[model samples]
Target: MASRRTTRRLAADAGLLVVAAAFVLPLAWVILSALDPHANLRVKTPDGLTLDNFDAILTPEITFTPLLNSLILCGGATLLTVVCAALAAYPLSRFRSRFNRPFLLTILFATSLPITAIMVPVYALFVQVDLIDTMQGTIFFFAASQLPFAIWLMKNFMDGVPKELEEAAWTDGASAFQSLLRIVLPLMGPGVSVVTVFSFVMMWGNFFVPFMLLLTPDQMPASVSINDFFGNRGMVAYGQLAAFSIVYSTPVILLYVLIARRLGGGFALGGAVKG
Candidate 1:
Protein backbone atom coordinates (compact mmCIF):
# COMPACT_ATOMS: atom_id res chain seq x y z
CA MET A 1 0.00 0.00 0.00
CA ALA A 2 2.78 2.44 0.94
CA SER A 3 4.64 1.69 -2.29
CA ARG A 4 1.51 2.27 -4.39
CA ARG A 5 0.80 5.64 -2.72
CA THR A 6 4.41 6.79 -3.30
CA THR A 7 4.26 5.73 -6.95
CA ARG A 8 1.02 7.72 -7.47
CA ARG A 9 2.52 10.81 -5.85
CA LEU A 10 5.58 10.59 -8.09
CA ALA A 11 3.37 10.18 -11.18
CA ALA A 12 1.30 13.27 -10.29
CA ASP A 13 4.40 15.39 -9.70
CA ALA A 14 5.90 14.25 -12.98
CA GLY A 15 2.68 15.06 -14.84
CA LEU A 16 2.59 18.58 -13.39
CA LEU A 17 6.23 19.14 -14.31
CA VAL A 18 5.55 18.08 -17.91
CA VAL A 19 2.60 20.49 -18.17
CA ALA A 20 4.63 23.39 -16.79
CA ALA A 21 7.47 22.71 -19.21
CA ALA A 22 5.09 22.47 -22.13
CA PHE A 23 3.82 26.02 -21.61
CA VAL A 24 7.14 27.56 -20.53
CA LEU A 25 9.26 26.06 -23.33
CA PRO A 26 7.42 27.85 -26.16
CA LEU A 27 7.62 31.21 -24.40
CA ALA A 28 11.31 30.66 -23.67
CA TRP A 29 11.92 29.77 -27.31
CA VAL A 30 10.19 32.93 -28.49
CA ILE A 31 12.23 35.14 -26.16
CA LEU A 32 15.48 33.51 -27.24
CA SER A 33 14.58 33.60 -30.94
CA ALA A 34 13.69 37.29 -30.71
CA LEU A 35 17.13 38.04 -29.32
CA ASP A 36 18.90 35.90 -31.93
CA PRO A 37 20.30 38.26 -34.58
CA HIS A 38 20.55 35.49 -37.14
CA ALA A 39 16.76 34.97 -37.34
CA ASN A 40 16.92 31.24 -36.66
CA LEU A 41 13.63 29.46 -35.89
CA ARG A 42 15.20 27.27 -33.23
CA VAL A 43 16.12 29.04 -30.00
CA LYS A 44 19.88 28.69 -29.36
CA THR A 45 22.19 30.16 -26.78
CA PRO A 46 23.97 33.10 -28.34
CA ASP A 47 27.76 33.27 -28.52
CA GLY A 48 27.50 37.08 -28.95
CA LEU A 49 24.04 38.68 -29.07
CA THR A 50 23.19 41.62 -31.28
CA LEU A 51 20.43 44.29 -31.18
CA ASP A 52 19.96 44.18 -34.98
CA ASN A 53 16.69 42.25 -34.58
CA PHE A 54 15.27 44.94 -32.28
CA ASP A 55 16.62 47.73 -34.47
CA ALA A 56 15.17 46.19 -37.62
CA ILE A 57 11.61 46.02 -36.30
CA LEU A 58 11.62 49.25 -34.26
CA THR A 59 10.77 51.46 -37.27
CA PRO A 60 7.83 53.85 -36.86
CA GLU A 61 5.88 52.93 -39.98
CA ILE A 62 5.79 49.18 -39.41
CA THR A 63 5.42 48.89 -35.62
CA PHE A 64 4.67 52.24 -34.00
CA THR A 65 1.52 53.22 -35.92
CA PRO A 66 -0.13 49.82 -35.50
CA LEU A 67 0.69 49.81 -31.77
CA LEU A 68 -0.74 53.30 -31.37
CA ASN A 69 -3.87 52.33 -33.26
CA SER A 70 -4.27 49.23 -31.04
CA LEU A 71 -3.97 51.43 -27.91
CA ILE A 72 -6.57 53.89 -29.19
CA LEU A 73 -9.04 51.25 -30.36
CA CYS A 74 -8.69 48.94 -27.37
CA GLY A 75 -8.45 51.74 -24.79
CA GLY A 76 -11.50 53.61 -26.09
CA ALA A 77 -13.57 50.44 -26.31
CA THR A 78 -12.64 49.40 -22.75
CA LEU A 79 -13.64 52.79 -21.32
CA LEU A 80 -16.99 52.77 -23.08
CA THR A 81 -17.64 49.10 -22.29
CA VAL A 82 -16.87 49.45 -18.59
CA VAL A 83 -18.94 52.61 -18.16
CA CYS A 84 -21.94 51.41 -20.17
CA ALA A 85 -21.83 47.94 -18.65
CA ALA A 86 -21.81 49.41 -15.15
CA LEU A 87 -24.73 51.75 -15.83
CA ALA A 88 -26.75 49.06 -17.58
CA ALA A 89 -25.95 46.53 -14.86
CA TYR A 90 -27.07 48.75 -11.96
CA PRO A 91 -30.69 48.74 -13.10
CA LEU A 92 -30.69 45.06 -14.01
CA SER A 93 -29.25 44.08 -10.65
CA ARG A 94 -31.48 46.41 -8.61
CA PHE A 95 -34.83 46.13 -10.38
CA ARG A 96 -37.22 43.16 -10.25
CA SER A 97 -38.62 43.11 -13.76
CA ARG A 98 -40.19 40.24 -15.70
CA PHE A 99 -38.24 41.34 -18.78
CA ASN A 100 -34.93 41.04 -16.88
CA ARG A 101 -34.75 37.25 -17.04
CA PRO A 102 -35.40 37.06 -20.77
CA PHE A 103 -33.13 40.03 -21.42
CA LEU A 104 -30.22 38.41 -19.59
CA LEU A 105 -30.83 35.14 -21.40
CA THR A 106 -30.73 37.02 -24.69
CA ILE A 107 -27.40 38.60 -23.72
CA LEU A 108 -26.00 35.17 -22.83
CA PHE A 109 -27.10 33.99 -26.21
CA ALA A 110 -25.48 36.97 -27.92
CA THR A 111 -22.14 36.20 -26.28
CA SER A 112 -22.01 32.89 -28.11
CA LEU A 113 -22.55 34.46 -31.55
CA PRO A 114 -19.39 34.24 -33.64
CA ILE A 115 -18.12 37.31 -35.48
CA THR A 116 -18.26 35.42 -38.78
CA ALA A 117 -22.02 35.04 -38.38
CA ILE A 118 -22.46 38.82 -38.20
CA MET A 119 -19.55 39.95 -40.40
CA VAL A 120 -21.52 40.30 -43.64
CA PRO A 121 -24.30 42.51 -42.27
CA VAL A 122 -21.94 44.31 -39.92
CA TYR A 123 -19.60 45.33 -42.74
CA ALA A 124 -22.55 46.31 -44.93
CA LEU A 125 -23.91 48.50 -42.14
CA PHE A 126 -20.47 50.09 -41.63
CA VAL A 127 -20.24 50.82 -45.35
CA GLN A 128 -23.69 52.40 -45.40
CA VAL A 129 -22.71 54.69 -42.51
CA ASP A 130 -19.37 55.67 -44.17
CA LEU A 131 -17.63 54.12 -41.16
CA ILE A 132 -15.35 51.70 -43.00
CA ASP A 133 -11.63 52.22 -42.32
CA THR A 134 -12.48 54.70 -39.55
CA MET A 135 -11.02 54.25 -36.04
CA GLN A 136 -14.10 55.58 -34.27
CA GLY A 137 -16.26 53.27 -36.34
CA THR A 138 -14.19 50.20 -35.49
CA ILE A 139 -14.17 51.18 -31.80
CA PHE A 140 -17.94 51.60 -31.71
CA PHE A 141 -18.38 48.02 -32.81
CA PHE A 142 -15.73 46.84 -30.34
CA ALA A 143 -17.49 48.53 -27.44
CA ALA A 144 -20.91 47.32 -28.57
CA SER A 145 -19.81 43.71 -29.08
CA GLN A 146 -18.25 43.48 -25.61
CA LEU A 147 -21.15 45.17 -23.78
CA PRO A 148 -23.51 42.18 -23.47
CA PHE A 149 -20.96 40.04 -21.65
CA ALA A 150 -19.59 43.02 -19.74
CA ILE A 151 -23.08 43.86 -18.47
CA TRP A 152 -23.60 40.26 -17.38
CA LEU A 153 -20.28 40.30 -15.53
CA MET A 154 -20.82 43.75 -13.99
CA LYS A 155 -24.27 42.75 -12.73
CA ASN A 156 -22.69 39.84 -10.85
CA PHE A 157 -20.18 42.21 -9.23
CA MET A 158 -22.79 44.87 -8.46
CA ASP A 159 -25.02 42.29 -6.79
CA GLY A 160 -22.31 41.87 -4.14
CA VAL A 161 -22.80 45.52 -3.03
CA PRO A 162 -25.35 45.93 -0.24
CA LYS A 163 -28.50 47.98 -0.84
CA GLU A 164 -28.01 49.52 2.60
CA LEU A 165 -25.08 51.46 1.26
CA GLU A 166 -27.29 52.96 -1.47
CA GLU A 167 -30.10 53.57 1.08
CA ALA A 168 -27.70 55.57 3.28
CA ALA A 169 -26.61 57.58 0.25
CA TRP A 170 -30.24 58.27 -0.67
CA THR A 171 -31.10 59.45 2.85
CA ASP A 172 -28.40 62.09 2.40
CA GLY A 173 -30.33 63.52 -0.59
CA ALA A 174 -28.37 61.63 -3.23
CA SER A 175 -29.87 60.68 -6.56
CA ALA A 176 -29.68 57.23 -8.11
CA PHE A 177 -26.76 58.27 -10.27
CA GLN A 178 -24.93 59.66 -7.26
CA SER A 179 -25.48 56.52 -5.26
CA LEU A 180 -24.15 54.41 -8.12
CA LEU A 181 -21.18 56.64 -8.79
CA ARG A 182 -20.06 57.27 -5.20
CA ILE A 183 -21.02 54.18 -3.22
CA VAL A 184 -21.36 51.24 -5.61
CA LEU A 185 -18.55 51.83 -8.10
CA PRO A 186 -15.70 52.14 -5.64
CA LEU A 187 -16.43 48.77 -4.09
CA MET A 188 -16.59 47.22 -7.53
CA GLY A 189 -13.04 48.24 -8.43
CA PRO A 190 -12.02 44.63 -9.10
CA GLY A 191 -14.86 43.99 -11.51
CA VAL A 192 -14.18 47.19 -13.46
CA SER A 193 -10.53 46.25 -13.64
CA VAL A 194 -11.41 42.77 -14.85
CA VAL A 195 -13.71 44.16 -17.52
CA THR A 196 -11.11 46.70 -18.61
CA VAL A 197 -8.43 44.04 -18.91
CA PHE A 198 -10.78 41.65 -20.68
CA SER A 199 -11.91 44.20 -23.26
CA PHE A 200 -8.40 45.48 -23.89
CA VAL A 201 -6.93 42.01 -24.33
CA MET A 202 -9.74 41.01 -26.67
CA MET A 203 -9.31 44.05 -28.90
CA TRP A 204 -5.56 43.89 -28.74
CA GLY A 205 -5.41 40.31 -29.99
CA ASN A 206 -8.33 40.56 -32.40
CA PHE A 207 -7.41 40.16 -36.06
CA PHE A 208 -10.66 39.42 -37.85
CA VAL A 209 -12.74 42.51 -37.01
CA PRO A 210 -10.03 45.05 -37.85
CA PHE A 211 -9.08 43.20 -41.01
CA MET A 212 -12.66 43.18 -42.32
CA LEU A 213 -13.40 46.79 -41.31
CA LEU A 214 -10.26 48.81 -42.02
CA LEU A 215 -9.03 49.27 -45.59
CA THR A 216 -5.93 51.40 -45.05
CA PRO A 217 -2.74 49.86 -43.71
CA ASP A 218 -1.87 53.05 -41.80
CA GLN A 219 -5.00 52.88 -39.64
CA MET A 220 -4.66 49.15 -38.94
CA PRO A 221 -4.08 47.85 -35.44
CA ALA A 222 -1.12 45.64 -34.42
CA SER A 223 -3.22 42.50 -34.64
CA VAL A 224 -3.83 43.15 -38.31
CA SER A 225 -0.44 44.64 -39.19
CA ILE A 226 1.68 41.82 -37.76
CA ASN A 227 1.05 39.97 -41.00
CA ASP A 228 3.15 42.53 -42.88
CA PHE A 229 6.34 41.06 -41.45
CA PHE A 230 5.61 37.78 -43.20
CA GLY A 231 6.39 38.68 -46.80
CA ASN A 232 4.08 37.59 -49.57
CA ARG A 233 7.08 36.44 -51.63
CA GLY A 234 7.87 33.55 -49.21
CA MET A 235 10.40 35.66 -47.34
CA VAL A 236 9.85 35.76 -43.58
CA ALA A 237 12.21 37.70 -41.29
CA TYR A 238 12.14 35.53 -38.19
CA GLY A 239 14.30 37.67 -35.86
CA GLN A 240 12.52 40.95 -36.57
CA LEU A 241 9.14 39.24 -36.40
CA ALA A 242 10.00 37.78 -33.01
CA ALA A 243 11.26 41.15 -31.77
CA PHE A 244 8.13 42.84 -33.08
CA SER A 245 6.01 40.26 -31.27
CA ILE A 246 7.74 41.17 -28.00
CA VAL A 247 7.23 44.89 -28.60
CA TYR A 248 3.62 44.44 -29.65
CA SER A 249 2.93 42.49 -26.45
CA THR A 250 4.38 45.13 -24.07
CA PRO A 251 1.28 47.32 -23.51
CA VAL A 252 -0.99 44.47 -22.43
CA ILE A 253 1.65 43.28 -19.99
CA LEU A 254 2.04 46.79 -18.55
CA LEU A 255 -1.71 47.20 -18.19
CA TYR A 256 -2.09 43.88 -16.40
CA VAL A 257 0.68 44.77 -13.95
CA LEU A 258 -0.73 48.24 -13.25
CA ILE A 259 -4.36 47.23 -12.63
CA ALA A 260 -3.92 43.67 -11.31
CA ARG A 261 -2.86 44.95 -7.89
CA ARG A 262 -6.42 46.10 -7.15
CA LEU A 263 -8.02 42.72 -7.90
CA GLY A 264 -6.80 40.84 -4.83
CA GLY A 265 -9.27 41.78 -2.09
CA GLY A 266 -12.86 42.93 -1.67
CA PHE A 267 -13.52 46.17 0.20
CA ALA A 268 -13.99 45.63 3.92
CA LEU A 269 -17.40 47.05 4.92
CA GLY A 270 -17.41 45.56 8.40
CA GLY A 271 -17.65 48.76 10.48
CA ALA A 272 -20.41 50.52 8.57
CA VAL A 273 -22.71 50.95 11.55
CA LYS A 274 -22.13 53.94 13.84
CA GLY A 275 -23.02 53.99 17.56
Candidate 2:
Protein backbone atom coordinates (compact mmCIF):
# COMPACT_ATOMS: atom_id res chain seq x y z
CA MET A 1 0.00 0.00 0.00
CA ALA A 2 2.81 2.38 0.90
CA SER A 3 4.64 1.63 -2.36
CA ARG A 4 1.46 2.18 -4.42
CA ARG A 5 0.81 5.56 -2.77
CA THR A 6 4.38 6.69 -3.46
CA THR A 7 4.11 5.65 -7.11
CA ARG A 8 0.81 7.56 -7.54
CA ARG A 9 2.28 10.69 -5.97
CA LEU A 10 5.31 10.51 -8.23
CA ALA A 11 3.09 10.04 -11.27
CA ALA A 12 0.96 13.06 -10.32
CA ASP A 13 4.02 15.25 -9.79
CA ALA A 14 5.48 14.22 -13.15
CA GLY A 15 2.19 14.93 -14.93
CA LEU A 16 1.98 18.40 -13.37
CA LEU A 17 5.56 19.19 -14.40
CA VAL A 18 4.82 18.24 -18.00
CA VAL A 19 1.74 20.50 -18.05
CA ALA A 20 3.72 23.38 -16.53
CA ALA A 21 6.46 23.01 -19.12
CA ALA A 22 3.98 23.16 -21.99
CA PHE A 23 2.99 26.68 -20.94
CA VAL A 24 6.39 27.83 -19.67
CA LEU A 25 8.30 26.79 -22.79
CA PRO A 26 6.31 29.07 -25.09
CA LEU A 27 6.82 32.01 -22.73
CA ALA A 28 10.54 31.19 -22.61
CA TRP A 29 10.66 31.17 -26.40
CA VAL A 30 8.89 34.55 -26.61
CA ILE A 31 11.31 36.21 -24.16
CA LEU A 32 14.40 34.53 -25.63
CA SER A 33 13.37 35.27 -29.20
CA ALA A 34 12.61 38.90 -28.39
CA LEU A 35 16.25 39.46 -27.37
CA ASP A 36 17.78 37.43 -30.22
CA PRO A 37 18.44 39.68 -33.22
CA HIS A 38 18.18 36.78 -35.67
CA ALA A 39 15.26 35.07 -33.94
CA ASN A 40 13.50 32.21 -35.67
CA LEU A 41 10.84 29.58 -34.98
CA ARG A 42 13.44 27.42 -33.15
CA VAL A 43 14.06 28.14 -29.45
CA LYS A 44 17.80 28.61 -28.93
CA THR A 45 20.32 31.06 -27.50
CA PRO A 46 21.44 33.84 -29.86
CA ASP A 47 25.05 34.83 -30.61
CA GLY A 48 24.37 38.30 -29.18
CA LEU A 49 21.43 39.94 -27.41
CA THR A 50 20.19 43.21 -28.88
CA LEU A 51 17.30 45.69 -28.55
CA ASP A 52 16.87 46.01 -32.30
CA ASN A 53 13.63 43.99 -32.24
CA PHE A 54 12.07 46.40 -29.76
CA ASP A 55 13.38 49.47 -31.62
CA ALA A 56 12.05 48.29 -34.97
CA ILE A 57 8.42 47.90 -33.76
CA LEU A 58 8.19 50.91 -31.39
CA THR A 59 6.96 53.31 -34.06
CA PRO A 60 3.53 54.99 -33.90
CA GLU A 61 2.32 53.03 -36.92
CA ILE A 62 3.28 49.66 -35.49
CA THR A 63 3.09 49.80 -31.66
CA PHE A 64 1.73 53.04 -30.21
CA THR A 65 -1.32 53.56 -32.44
CA PRO A 66 -2.72 50.02 -32.24
CA LEU A 67 -2.04 49.83 -28.50
CA LEU A 68 -3.90 53.10 -28.01
CA ASN A 69 -6.78 51.79 -30.09
CA SER A 70 -6.84 48.56 -28.01
CA LEU A 71 -6.92 50.58 -24.78
CA ILE A 72 -9.83 52.62 -26.07
CA LEU A 73 -11.76 49.66 -27.45
CA CYS A 74 -11.18 47.16 -24.64
CA GLY A 75 -11.35 49.79 -21.90
CA GLY A 76 -14.68 51.16 -23.12
CA ALA A 77 -16.18 47.68 -23.54
CA THR A 78 -14.98 46.50 -20.10
CA LEU A 79 -16.48 49.54 -18.34
CA LEU A 80 -19.76 49.07 -20.14
CA THR A 81 -19.82 45.31 -19.39
CA VAL A 82 -19.12 45.82 -15.68
CA VAL A 83 -21.80 48.49 -15.24
CA CYS A 84 -24.43 46.56 -17.17
CA ALA A 85 -23.58 43.29 -15.42
CA ALA A 86 -23.85 44.93 -12.00
CA LEU A 87 -27.23 46.42 -12.79
CA ALA A 88 -28.52 43.18 -14.30
CA ALA A 89 -27.13 41.03 -11.49
CA TYR A 90 -28.39 43.10 -8.54
CA PRO A 91 -32.02 42.11 -9.01
CA LEU A 92 -31.17 38.45 -9.58
CA SER A 93 -29.09 38.42 -6.40
CA ARG A 94 -31.53 40.30 -4.11
CA PHE A 95 -34.95 39.36 -5.40
CA ARG A 96 -36.85 36.07 -5.42
CA SER A 97 -38.42 35.16 -8.73
CA ARG A 98 -38.97 32.05 -10.85
CA PHE A 99 -37.74 33.85 -13.94
CA ASN A 100 -34.24 34.45 -12.57
CA ARG A 101 -33.04 30.86 -12.99
CA PRO A 102 -34.29 30.66 -16.57
CA PHE A 103 -32.73 34.01 -17.38
CA LEU A 104 -29.40 32.94 -15.86
CA LEU A 105 -29.53 29.65 -17.71
CA THR A 106 -30.14 31.55 -20.92
CA ILE A 107 -27.09 33.68 -20.23
CA LEU A 108 -25.00 30.57 -19.57
CA PHE A 109 -26.23 29.17 -22.85
CA ALA A 110 -25.31 32.38 -24.61
CA THR A 111 -21.75 32.19 -23.26
CA SER A 112 -21.26 28.73 -24.75
CA LEU A 113 -22.16 29.84 -28.25
CA PRO A 114 -19.05 30.41 -30.38
CA ILE A 115 -18.47 33.93 -31.75
CA THR A 116 -17.86 32.45 -35.20
CA ALA A 117 -21.36 30.96 -35.31
CA ILE A 118 -22.98 34.41 -35.36
CA MET A 119 -20.35 36.50 -37.13
CA VAL A 120 -21.99 36.15 -40.52
CA PRO A 121 -25.28 37.67 -39.41
CA VAL A 122 -23.52 40.20 -37.20
CA TYR A 123 -21.36 41.35 -40.11
CA ALA A 124 -24.39 41.70 -42.33
CA LEU A 125 -26.24 43.72 -39.67
CA PHE A 126 -23.24 46.00 -39.19
CA VAL A 127 -23.09 46.62 -42.93
CA GLN A 128 -26.82 47.34 -43.05
CA VAL A 129 -26.58 49.86 -40.19
CA ASP A 130 -23.52 51.59 -41.74
CA LEU A 131 -21.46 50.65 -38.66
CA ILE A 132 -19.14 48.17 -40.38
CA ASP A 133 -15.85 49.90 -39.63
CA THR A 134 -16.77 52.25 -36.76
CA MET A 135 -15.06 52.17 -33.34
CA GLN A 136 -18.35 52.67 -31.48
CA GLY A 137 -19.89 49.77 -33.36
CA THR A 138 -17.00 47.46 -32.43
CA ILE A 139 -17.15 48.63 -28.82
CA PHE A 140 -20.85 47.81 -28.63
CA PHE A 141 -20.25 44.34 -30.07
CA PHE A 142 -17.40 43.70 -27.63
CA ALA A 143 -19.62 44.66 -24.68
CA ALA A 144 -22.47 42.46 -25.86
CA SER A 145 -20.19 39.47 -26.44
CA GLN A 146 -18.80 39.69 -22.88
CA LEU A 147 -21.97 40.72 -21.03
CA PRO A 148 -23.50 37.24 -20.58
CA PHE A 149 -20.60 35.67 -18.69
CA ALA A 150 -19.98 38.92 -16.82
CA ILE A 151 -23.53 38.86 -15.46
CA TRP A 152 -23.16 35.22 -14.39
CA LEU A 153 -19.93 35.95 -12.54
CA MET A 154 -21.27 39.14 -10.98
CA LYS A 155 -24.45 37.47 -9.75
CA ASN A 156 -22.50 34.61 -8.14
CA PHE A 157 -20.20 37.05 -6.35
CA MET A 158 -23.07 39.34 -5.35
CA ASP A 159 -24.74 36.34 -3.74
CA GLY A 160 -21.89 36.17 -1.21
CA VAL A 161 -22.75 39.67 0.11
CA PRO A 162 -25.27 39.69 2.99
CA LYS A 163 -28.66 41.33 2.46
CA GLU A 164 -29.03 42.63 6.03
CA LEU A 165 -26.73 45.56 5.26
CA GLU A 166 -28.95 46.55 2.38
CA GLU A 167 -32.01 46.43 4.68
CA ALA A 168 -30.27 48.76 7.11
CA ALA A 169 -29.51 51.15 4.26
CA TRP A 170 -33.14 50.94 3.16
CA THR A 171 -34.29 52.00 6.65
CA ASP A 172 -32.03 55.03 6.27
CA GLY A 173 -34.02 56.11 3.14
CA ALA A 174 -31.66 54.67 0.55
CA SER A 175 -33.18 53.65 -2.77
CA ALA A 176 -32.47 50.29 -4.44
CA PHE A 177 -29.90 51.84 -6.74
CA GLN A 178 -28.37 53.77 -3.86
CA SER A 179 -28.06 50.65 -1.72
CA LEU A 180 -26.52 48.78 -4.61
CA LEU A 181 -23.96 51.50 -5.33
CA ARG A 182 -23.02 52.28 -1.73
CA ILE A 183 -23.43 48.96 0.05
CA VAL A 184 -23.59 45.83 -2.11
CA LEU A 185 -21.10 46.85 -4.77
CA PRO A 186 -18.57 48.17 -2.30
CA LEU A 187 -18.77 44.91 -0.40
CA MET A 188 -18.36 42.81 -3.57
CA GLY A 189 -15.16 44.45 -4.74
CA PRO A 190 -13.53 41.15 -5.69
CA GLY A 191 -16.42 40.22 -7.96
CA VAL A 192 -16.28 43.56 -9.77
CA SER A 193 -12.54 43.16 -10.25
CA VAL A 194 -12.93 39.66 -11.66
CA VAL A 195 -15.59 40.79 -14.10
CA THR A 196 -13.63 43.85 -15.18
CA VAL A 197 -10.38 41.93 -15.70
CA PHE A 198 -12.12 39.06 -17.46
CA SER A 199 -14.01 41.37 -19.82
CA PHE A 200 -11.01 43.52 -20.68
CA VAL A 201 -8.65 40.60 -21.20
CA MET A 202 -11.17 38.74 -23.34
CA MET A 203 -11.74 41.77 -25.55
CA TRP A 204 -8.05 42.66 -25.67
CA GLY A 205 -6.87 39.24 -26.87
CA ASN A 206 -9.72 38.77 -29.31
CA PHE A 207 -8.49 38.83 -32.93
CA PHE A 208 -11.56 37.76 -34.85
CA VAL A 209 -14.27 40.11 -33.54
CA PRO A 210 -12.51 43.41 -34.27
CA PHE A 211 -11.05 41.96 -37.45
CA MET A 212 -14.51 41.26 -38.84
CA LEU A 213 -16.14 44.47 -37.63
CA LEU A 214 -13.53 47.18 -38.20
CA LEU A 215 -12.29 47.61 -41.78
CA THR A 216 -10.35 50.89 -41.52
CA PRO A 217 -6.62 50.36 -40.94
CA ASP A 218 -6.40 53.39 -38.65
CA GLN A 219 -9.13 52.02 -36.38
CA MET A 220 -7.71 48.51 -35.95
CA PRO A 221 -6.76 47.52 -32.39
CA ALA A 222 -3.51 45.84 -31.42
CA SER A 223 -5.23 42.46 -31.43
CA VAL A 224 -6.08 42.83 -35.11
CA SER A 225 -2.99 44.78 -36.14
CA ILE A 226 -0.61 42.12 -34.81
CA ASN A 227 -1.42 40.03 -37.89
CA ASP A 228 0.67 42.48 -39.93
CA PHE A 229 3.80 40.74 -38.60
CA PHE A 230 3.20 37.94 -41.10
CA GLY A 231 4.38 39.03 -44.54
CA ASN A 232 2.79 38.02 -47.86
CA ARG A 233 5.52 35.49 -48.69
CA GLY A 234 5.03 33.48 -45.43
CA MET A 235 8.02 35.29 -43.92
CA VAL A 236 7.50 36.40 -40.33
CA ALA A 237 9.66 38.83 -38.40
CA TYR A 238 9.89 36.49 -35.42
CA GLY A 239 12.05 38.83 -33.31
CA GLN A 240 9.78 41.85 -33.78
CA LEU A 241 6.70 39.70 -33.36
CA ALA A 242 7.99 38.37 -30.04
CA ALA A 243 8.77 41.92 -28.87
CA PHE A 244 5.29 43.12 -29.79
CA SER A 245 3.74 40.14 -27.96
CA ILE A 246 5.55 41.05 -24.73
CA VAL A 247 4.37 44.67 -24.99
CA TYR A 248 0.87 43.51 -25.93
CA SER A 249 0.68 41.45 -22.72
CA THR A 250 1.81 44.26 -20.37
CA PRO A 251 -1.57 45.95 -19.89
CA VAL A 252 -3.36 42.79 -18.79
CA ILE A 253 -0.53 41.98 -16.38
CA LEU A 254 -0.71 45.52 -14.96
CA LEU A 255 -4.48 45.25 -14.55
CA TYR A 256 -4.09 42.07 -12.52
CA VAL A 257 -1.43 43.72 -10.35
CA LEU A 258 -3.65 46.73 -9.67
CA ILE A 259 -6.55 44.53 -8.54
CA ALA A 260 -4.52 41.83 -6.81
CA ARG A 261 -5.41 43.02 -3.32
CA ARG A 262 -9.15 43.19 -3.94
CA LEU A 263 -9.25 39.79 -5.68
CA GLY A 264 -7.55 38.12 -2.70
CA GLY A 265 -9.53 39.93 0.00
CA GLY A 266 -12.69 38.00 0.72
CA PHE A 267 -15.84 39.78 1.87
CA ALA A 268 -15.16 41.10 5.40
CA LEU A 269 -18.78 40.92 6.50
CA GLY A 270 -17.96 39.24 9.83
CA GLY A 271 -19.37 41.83 12.26
CA ALA A 272 -21.80 43.64 9.93
CA VAL A 273 -24.73 41.28 10.62
CA LYS A 274 -25.61 40.28 14.20
CA GLY A 275 -28.33 37.90 15.38
* TM-score for each predicted model, relative to the true structure: 0.89, 0.88
Cα RMSD (Å) per model? 5.6, 5.1
User: What is the C-alpha RMSD, rounded to one decimal, of candidate 1?
Assistant: 5.6
Name the runs in model 2 displaced over 4 angstroms.
Answer: 1-11, 232-235, 254-275
lDDT of 1 by residue, 23-74 (tens): 8877776688787767577757854677888887778888888898998998
Q: What is the lDDT of candidate 2?
A: 0.88
Off by over 4 Å in 1: 1-6, 232-234, 254-275
lDDT of 2 at 124: 98
> Which candidate gets the maximum lDDT versus the true structure?
2
Backbone atom clashes (below 3 Å) for every candidate: 0, 0
For candidate 2, the per-residue lDDT at 190 reads 71
lDDT (Cα, tens digit) per residue for candidate 2, span 129-246: 9989999999999999999988988888899999999999999999999999999999988768878887898899899999899998899999888888884427798999999999
Q: Clashing residue pairs, candidate 2? A: none
